[model samples]
Target: MHFPVSGVDVFPLIPPAVAFAVSSVTACAGTSGAFLLLPFMVSVLGFTSPAVSPTNFIYNIVAIPGGLARYIREGRMAWPLTWVIILGTLPGVFAGAWIRICYLSDLKAFKLFVGLVLLYLGIRLLYESAGRYLKTREQTIALEKKFQERMRKIKSKTSTHLAAGIPAEAVVKNRLVSLRKIEYDFWGETFSFNTITIFILALVVGLVGGIYGIGGGTIIAPFCVSILGLPVYTVAGAALAGTFLTSIAGVVFYVVLAFTPLGMHNAFSPDWFLGVLFGFGGFWGTYCGACMQKFLPERLIRGVLGILVTILAASYVIQFLII
Candidate 1:
């Protein structure tokens, strides 16, 4: 199928199928996989335009609700963290969108920026996965192991005895929220972090995500898990929620800009049909990832994801410098 808006042509089924494959993996880390998908759209599909950013946002809008709902239904949503991230991210996304159109429209510069961001994130995650100072990574693995054992027990029961959904013991509970700090309890362990620190981090990540078309969750999730000493199970829901809302804001900004004089000069509006196709795949993928998260080892997930991201980052940088 040919999408005129972005001037891309490919098999109709390819977008969703690829999105499904990518989202299924990234969603386990509280991201919608837009970061990975953007690279695919650019390098593989040859969609390098300002509109691509908003198209990515549309995917987040359509795709995130599935996993977000799953997280909420399982009582894992961290309301305080979600709100803080949204508040910090909204403004940054707007700023980043403007910068994307005004300054980073050139394909080479944008790719380089993306390469650097991914490289930093890849290194950060790989460092965390090294298990040196990340008590939270270790804690998350232990907690998830316990949760999975419980899930096995629940599954082993007869249909009549099986629990309706995630057990209450596995749910996340907000213990406290303040300007300076926030605390949450997960499976009897209380995790605390500085609120201002997260807010600042989200703001920066939002800027970078907006430029790269990812909605900040890709960076936020790992930062929360690796640096802030938060459990992955508790952090995933909040990060996804924040990304969803921010993406909505980003799409609005890009759409509104597309209607202005700027639209004539730059492709700011999204290809809705193409985005929806990717969303369809991402919806089921994210849902599946959320459902399967507790069964996977955190160490394995982080190690694999870090390696993949690092390789992709290296490829982009090399392509930029050599090709």
Candidate 2:
């Protein structure tokens, strides 16, 4: 079947499944598979249009919930962090939608903007992986090791189950004061970090995502884990929750922008049929990714995902400069 808006042929099971796989893997390190898929749509599928951005957002809308549900089931959702992220991200998405339609209609300029954003974010994540975050990950690992030993002792000693009243509460008792410091205690273990700095960082990440039609989790997740010294297990749900709300805002903003007077000659609107088609595949993929995420080691997960994202960033940079 031919998809009209982007002029790409839709194949059964193949396209959506490809989106699902990309999202499922990339999301492990807190990125929406949408970033990588955009290039695929343009270079491979020949679906290069402004509508592609919102269609990418549509993929997020479908793919994220499955993983989020898994996180909820595993008692890992961070409600407080989720709330802060959504509150900040929603308006920015709208502003970004406007900018894309009004000023960034030039694909070349937008490509450069997109390249620079990915380049900066990719380098930051790489730096964190190489050395800056090593000590923090070690400390977190030490604390987690201690916690696991305690859990093993309890499981062996007690027959109490969840119904027997084991409380697993996810609440933010302390406010993040600054980038150099944030502290949270969970399961009788205290974790501290520099949080104030990350808020500024998160904002910049959000803007890049806004411009490029992405969920901030892809960027925020690594910062939370490597730089802020938060556990990926807990942050995954929070980041997913944040991405969910922001995408909702992004879609609405794009739809509204489609009706307004913009620089473009064509009546710009998201191709709903195309978006939904991608979403159908992404939904199942996220479900599987989220479940597997719990079983995977944290270091392996981040290392693999970082390499993939860096490669994608490099591709975009090379394509932009070369073409």
Candidate 3:
């Protein structure tokens, strides 16, 4: 398939397959996988133009809805948090898009910026993981043992009675929502965060996400979990919702910009055909990943994501230095 806008020629199946693989893992952490996919488009697909950023955003527009629907259906959508994230990130995304088009069009500089952002996120996750391990190792072990026992009982109870494809019951309930704070309950535990703090973080994340075409969830979710001490289960849905909304705005912004003289000079229009191809796979991948997240251990998911981000960040930095 030749996508003239992206100046790439390859099998049509490649993008979707890669997107499916990436989104399956990333969606578990509330990311739409654009952070990883952007790199793939640039390095593997030869999409290095500024237009690539908006193209990546288009993937989020298509890929996020399925996962968002899953989260909402599962009663995991944190509405208050979602609104806060959306409001804060919306303006910043516009600013970031402008910056990307005007200043960061140079691929080298853009890659370096992405490398630094990834490095920061990876290190933050690892540090949080280590801190958690040190502070709560005994408690965590005890909790895991208890959880395993509960799961065993559940399995025994459902072995014959439940249908093979049916998911276990899990729900999120609101405990509180206020101007200063927000709280929710998932399973049995309550998770709380400062609303103001999250809004501030979202603003910064929006800027980075806009420039990177990731829609801020990739950054915000980890920050919520690691820095704000929020549970991943609750954070995942809210992050996805925020990402979805922001991505819609981003795509529209790019489309409008594409007609202007500035847009023509910098290839500001998105490669919609290529993006939709990636989105086709991402849609199913995100749906499956969101559904499976409840079955996986939080620690295991975070550890894997941290490691993957670290490796990708290192590779980007190394490539830049080599070049």
Evaluate model 2: give its TM-score.
0.82
What TM-score does each of the candidates earn?
0.92, 0.82, 0.92
Write model 3 residue lDDT over 133-154, tens digit each, in one string.
Answer: 5265443344345455666677
Give, for candidate 2, the lowest lDDT window spanning 10 residues: 162-171
For model 1, residues 230-308, the per-residue Cα lDDT tens digits are: 8777788899999899999999999999889988887899999989999999999999888867666666667778898
Model 3, total clashes = 0
Candidate 2 vs candidate 3: the lDDT winner is 3
Stretches of candidate 3 off by over 4 Å are: 131-146, 155-169
lDDT (C-alpha) at residue 213 in model 2: 83
Backbone N/Cα/C clashes per model = 0, 12, 0
lDDT of 2 by residue, 213-241 (tens): 88666667777776667777677778888
Residue 63 lDDT (model 1): 91
Report, for every candidate in turn, its global Cα lDDT versus the true structure: 0.85, 0.68, 0.83
Off by over 4 Å in 1: 133-168
